[model samples]
Target: MASRQTRLRVISLYKELHRLGRDYPDPSYNFHGKLRGLFEKNKDLKDEAEIEKAIKLGEYIRNETLALYSLRKYRHLKRMYPAVSPTDPFP
Candidate 1:
């Protein structure tokens, strides 16, 4: 039996990941569905150590996904407003 802390941690992580999926670029890829499936696949873990390890992995994935979204947004903005060269003085 998993401790209450572990259970709460797992639920929160799952919710946060699903929330993050809202901003995912490709709807057809079904990011939320994949996340759900991953959580379901791990629902039978009986060891605290194993659960913690899985939680850590999920956090890592969340951070990476966030970075990816941030990069995409940055690229979009950069394209809209090209950076001016430092050597070029303003008119």
Candidate 2:
């Protein structure tokens, strides 16, 4: 039997992933498909240890996704407004 905390974490992770997926490129196809496939693939996991491992992996993936999004946003901003170098001061 899974603990209440574990179950809640699982639910939270699932919802967060889907929510983030909407912001992901190709949300309708690639992101959703891959997300669904991953959960489905692990649907039958019964061992507590395995489930915990999966949860940890999911958390890691979530963090990575956020990092990627941040990097992409930063790049886009940089492209729009190129950074000024300290050595080259002036408009």
Candidate 3:
């Protein structure tokens, strides 16, 4: 059986990812469903090394999701305000 700490951390990570999936960029993709499915697929892992590896992968995914959100915001901002040129006078 995995240690209590490990179990708690896994649950917390799952919750975090689930929350992030709420605003996932692609409306066609079911992020929350996919997240749950993946977690279910790995729930039987008994080896610590394997579990750790999976957690690391999950964290990497979380980071990538945040990056995607940031890029989306950047695109929106860029669209709203075109870059000013040197020749343009400040308003």
Highest lDDT among the candidates is held by which one?
3
List clashing residue pairs in candidate 2.
Answer: none
Off by over 4 Å in 1: 85-91
* Predicted structure 3, TM vs. truth: 0.93
Q: What is the TM-score of each candidate against the true structure?
A: 0.89, 0.82, 0.93
Model 3 misplacement above 4 A: none
Where in model 2 is the C-alpha error above 4 Å?
A: 26-29, 85-91
Q: Give the alpha-carbon lDDT of every model.
A: 0.92, 0.86, 0.93
lDDT of 3 at 28: 86
Candidate 3 lDDT over 1-91, as tens digits, reads: 7889999999999999998999998878999888999999999999999999999999999999999999999999999998888888893
Return the clash pairs for model 3, or none.
Answer: none
TM-score quality measure for candidate 2: 0.82
Score candidate 1 by TM-score against the native.
0.89
Question: In model 2, which range of ten residues has the least summed lDDT?
Answer: 25-34
- As for lDDT, the candidate ahead, 1 or 3, is 3
- Candidate 3: residue 86 Cα off by (Å): 2.5
Ranking by TM-score: 3, 1, 2
lDDT by residue for model 1 over 1-91, one digit each (tens)? 9999889989999999999999998889999889989999999999888988999999999999999999999999989986788887882
Better by lDDT, candidate 2 or 1: 1
